[model samples]
Target: MKDVPVYTKSQLALRNGQDKPQIWIAFKGVIYDVTDSRLWKNGKHYEHWAGQDLTLELKDAPHSSSVFERFKVIGILG
Candidate 1:
């Protein structure tokens, strides 16, 4: 398998769509690109924002982590 790149929180912060036009969010140390997701348009999904870890926020979400499976894996948090 190909090695996934690792990205820092600050680096992830820049991909929030508003900052770099690539909306991304991290979960369980894995980053997924959500730029094309209508739910994530403008980097805001409900009250959650992109470019940050959402591990702790999932419990409040209506869906499971598998919801991220549709997006591309951008990197792993470091």
Candidate 2:
């Protein structure tokens, strides 16, 4: 089996949203759901992934290469 790659916060930011089912996002080796996470403003990260929103984010989190390898398109709220 191939090992999953990790990504940084800034790296994951590149693929905020796309038409894909899930986009992997790694923070400290732990992946998160960024699909429904708000990316419009700063300091609101916690609020977006506090409840059901996390489920969406987790579902969208990528499972392929790291952000450095390719761009994982995700959904961003306006």
Candidate 3:
């Protein structure tokens, strides 16, 4: 199988809509495209934002990481 592309935090930041146009977030080092989700509109999710590692934040979320399964895996966070 092919390996996922790894992205740095700085590189991921460009997808925050403010910087570019896409919205991406990392959870447990795996990056997911949240662009199509209404929850991620404008690259912001409540107090969280795109281009971030959400592993630690998930603890406070109502849902688990499985929620990310619906979204596409764009890459990995390095």
TM-score of each: 0.95, 0.27, 0.92
Q: Candidate 1 residues 1-78, lDDT tens each?
A: 159999999999999889899999999999999999999999999999998999999999989998988999998999
Order of candidates by TM-score, top first?
1, 3, 2
**Model 1, TM vs. native:** 0.95
Which tens-of-lDDT digit does each residue in 1-78 have in candidate 2?
135454544555444344233343444344445444345222134333211223335445454235323333332221
Q: Where does candidate 3 clash, by residue pair? A: none
Alpha-carbon RMSD of each model: 1.1, 11.7, 1.2
Q: Ten residues in a row with the worst lDDT in model 3?
A: 1-10
Query: What does the lDDT read for residue 21 in candidate 1?
Result: 93
Deviation from native of the Cα of residue 25 in model 3, angstroms: 0.2
Tell me the tens digit of each residue's lDDT in model 3 across 1-78: 158887899999888967888999988888899999999999999999888888899999988878999999999888
By TM-score, the better pick of 2 and 3 is: 3
Predicted structure with the largest lDDT when compared to the true one:
1
